[model samples]
Target: MRLTPDEGDLTARAFARLDARLTRDTGRPVALALSGGGDSIALLRLATEWARARGRSVLALTVDHGLNPESGGWTAFAAEAARAAGADWCGLSWDGDKPQTGLTAAARAARHGLIAQAAREAGARVVLFAQTADDIAEADLMRSEGSTLGRVREWSPSPAWPQGRGLMLLRPLLGERRAVLRDWLAGQGADWIEDPANVDPKFGRSRARQALAGAAPPAPEEARALAGGRPTMDGEAMVNVRRDIGARALAAALVCVGGGATPPRGARLQALTARLRAGENFAATLCGARIEAAGDAVRVMREAGDLGRRGTAPQVLTPGVEAVWDGRFTFRAEHPGWSVEAARGRLASLSDADRTEINRLPAATRGAWPVLIRDGALAPVLAGEGVERRALVAERLRLALDETTHEDDLISATR
Candidate 1:
């Protein structure tokens, strides 16, 4: 349903409140991912107003994924909209060759990477997305169809660090419907571009959206429940407080600790949960992560077998370009051709002091710990040795754990 004028004002006020909270936590300006779509354009407009009143900066970043012929024009249109809304604007492009298969997934990853990079360069720690209630409902429907996609949290730490650079993605419009946002824009005499892909039945999201036409939108309570609680993870284990959390949060934790891109199967996760509840000491592996039950807690660590199976292929680390090696650590070397590989076997070659220092980490993590090589010899660079390195997997685990562990505070703030 369309939003009334008063409802639109309330939505703007809600955006302002959410933006203020994020700014306070991150202590940085706001960065909006603009796409010239109704939801994003509305966000740009609202964010511009909010920032102006608070004397804060708002950057609008338009990422051209270069997938469609009209993507360039779309970027230009987004730029114009941002400028009209009194926000600083920048255009980013995904320049590399697109993958033939999984084009949508590749383009999405590229878009987020480019946007995160731009936001970091602009000194913004929080990137705002224009996802609305309608989108959330559609995603829920897709999940019900066994899509294996996770729910989008209102506040999420970037999964890929260095490239993401510790940026937080904030979806402030999750409580607002898309039609309401469009109506608000219409009232303001603003127009938005309707991407042709939105109606294409080949896209799963498009099909889901079509299926949602006569379906009742997700209830507010259900949406909040689906948003789930924050995660709590100790260095070695994730505390699974089942009643306070959901499968998606657990899956995210497993993926984060497992260092795998895809999450474990839902059935596998459920079985693990049952085992944990049964209070049986057991060990299982899924999604490249090893889960070991230990007295009411489940410890998640990188699977050694998976690491060994990855083979000793050293990835070339280029200067200024961030790369996540082995899905464990994000690193950018000062020089080119710096090959990053597992620290296994090579740890003995290290000096006594270096070995001692590296031993402080968990034994399971040591095998996958980043070790650099240059000219076929081990480089002296280590994680804390003035090197640009971010433990992405560990960071994700920690953040997700923290969020779930202290979910009450987060829920209270949202209320």
Candidate 2:
């Protein structure tokens, strides 16, 4: 059924609300992702009229995920609706083969990709999504139910583009409820596509949506806070500054030992560790070697894994420094606790698979190992035939304990 011109009135109002929410300034185009669903169709209809009033036009994009067999038919319906609404409509399709993880995440990623592409093609700065308050509330529920705080903050600014990606994602109707959108659409005599999968229990979001259908609607302020709508500065600037400062400072603090193979320990490492914890000049990499910041000292070990275990070592560091085991212990420059020659020999003794495993790690993790570079050559501790690998491990553990205690002291000092 064709929507009459009279239906354009309600849509226009909805569009105005969306516009006011997304764009406070004028003379800019707004791109709408029209899904041929009740919410998006209503959005597109109103957006067109709203744009007309501002001497602009609506750029509508319909993404065909191809998940449903009837998606082609739906696409045609969406295009026609766009035409009726007087929007410059475009269609996008996805062509990726199915993955083992099923189609939901893939389809969402594809849909956003298409929307971004269409928005870019139209030269539109802001791409509007019809997500509503219910969506936010449901996500809130999901977060509250989960134990991991990591999952709650994963909705980062979209990385779809290098510069304008932030503009590519704006949920204008995010403050509205699904029922409100439906009511507004009904007033326009409009209908929308109802995907059966939306109600399927197997999908976590589907279940969440179903639960949301019965819950009391959220307050506007609560929704706004969850969506990060308070006053803010440039997040990109903050992140870049943090990463650069942290990385460089850490790099500078690292002390090379065992002919530049092993890292520093006791006081030298502790000083570096102090700066790292203070969020000051950090110059170390956690990806390669393990570093522990203790009271006024930092300890470095060449081997540490996710499970918090450090393997055997003579603890070779820089060319001039090495911690050697000989049933009796000593620090030497020429013999260097463990000789640079002995360290090189140990690395050569490793099997091909062990070498591959070590090499596969990132530079940060690999740097943490008890290996050192002597004149640009790989060097590792030979584990001093009779000296127990367990002794070196015990010393590393003690350093870690000291680091923890010092970290607590730093925190207490700050407080």
Candidate 3:
């Protein structure tokens, strides 16, 4: 019986590609979302061998969606399989009420969020996914059927909001077929769970999978669309797209500003994108972001809302603990007894110069800016004494505008 993947085999090579991608400290464990399915089980086994040789560890996380009656059993199997494969295991569950209409999408988002949080807490900067060649074909088919399921790539930043802030996802098995992995598992005498949902007709993925009729996965070619035109961003992350930007680029910019899970719909987004390309002067709202375009320049920012409703929801800071607020900013405080909230009522207390600068921003942004607070006194966005703050929205816009963003979305073949 085979105890490890053959060194020259595709599976081994797939795991080997992780060497250059891991930029974190060598001591930190690499994370995997193990579902006990054929693909993930194969990856966990192969990765176990890969990590051991590199003096690293693997953390396998199994998320129990609780949608199936046998979910508990699946979780148990995943834990056992991970441990048997010489990897650490953790079981996470989806604990809230399920949405009746979009259970699939909601479950996926929740699963990602849970995994991202767990990985971050464990100091894992990269999350390994078992997305195989078959999964890619299936995603394409699902999209053709008008499903909004996102395009899966070999490597990309985690799509889950705030929780996925600092994590990158690596799909090493993207070049391998599901059947190849299953055959390898069989050779290794490994058993895997088959989730019944994979065959359910109600789901788009299931339908897409069944429609394949055993066709081969498409070639490992790049499918991302690269956009043109650089965007100028300011200190506030106000994006000014002067030249031309694609729908995806605009959508990404709005995602940063809106800080919402859902991007703008295709029709409305295409319409607005056309207007921007034509250099029309107009203002509009999509998702939670407000856009103002003038003379070939498009600027986006978070829309002003009823901040008092939640009042920016002050989050107590823990010493050396990093937290994300409103999905736009990441905050870290060196010492405790501090918190972060909105610049609502405290805006009136700003110095004359501070007030003048704040007024320069759109009315949509003035009151909602994040403020560091201590003993009920509001501190400026630039907090003192070991406080570290970063605007996630700005980073997102920068990535969206960078031409190399899409070009570097895949793992290097040679590496």
Cα lDDT tens digits for candidate 2, 308-353: 3433343453334323432112334443233322222344554565
TM-score winner:
3
Pairs of residues clashing in candidate 1: 230-403, 230-404, 231-401, 231-403, 231-404, 232-401, 233-401
Number of clashes recorded per candidate: 7, 42, 0
lDDT for each of the candidates?
Answer: 0.70, 0.49, 0.76
Looking at candidate 1, what is the lDDT of residue 303?
A: 70
Question: Mind giving the per-residue lDDT tens digits that candidate 3 earns over 1-415?
Answer: 5434432386547755666465323777889999999999988988888887778899999999999999999899999999998999999999988998988888999999999889978977778999988988998888787877767776666777777765677788888888878888888788999888899998888989999958988755453654755555656656666537877777877777877766675678999888877777898888677788877556887766645554456788888877877778777888877788777777877777778878888777677777777756644553647888877776555443332232133222101
lDDT of 3 at 247: 79
Sort the predicted structures by lDDT, highest score first. 3, 1, 2
lDDT by residue for model 1 (1-415), tens:
4567755575566666564455433335688899999989988888877777666778999988887899988998999889888988999988988888888777887888788878877777677898877887888988888776667766765544346635667777777777777778887789899998999999989999898875656633222343345455554323343332456666766787766656676788888766766677877787877766666555666676677886867778777777777666677777665677777767777667778877886676566566777757654335433347666554555455434322223322111
Question: For candidate 3, which ten residues in a row score worst on lDDT?
Answer: 406-415
Scored by lDDT, model 3 comes in at 0.76
Q: Candidate 3: which pairs clash?
A: none
Rank order (by TM-score, best first): 3, 1, 2
In model 3, what is the error at residue 273, expressed in angstroms? 1.0
Runs in model 1 with CA error above 4 Å?
Answer: 1-11, 24-27, 159-162, 214-216, 219-249, 260-262, 294-297, 312-327, 330-340, 351-365, 372-394, 401-415
TM-score of each: 0.79, 0.51, 0.87
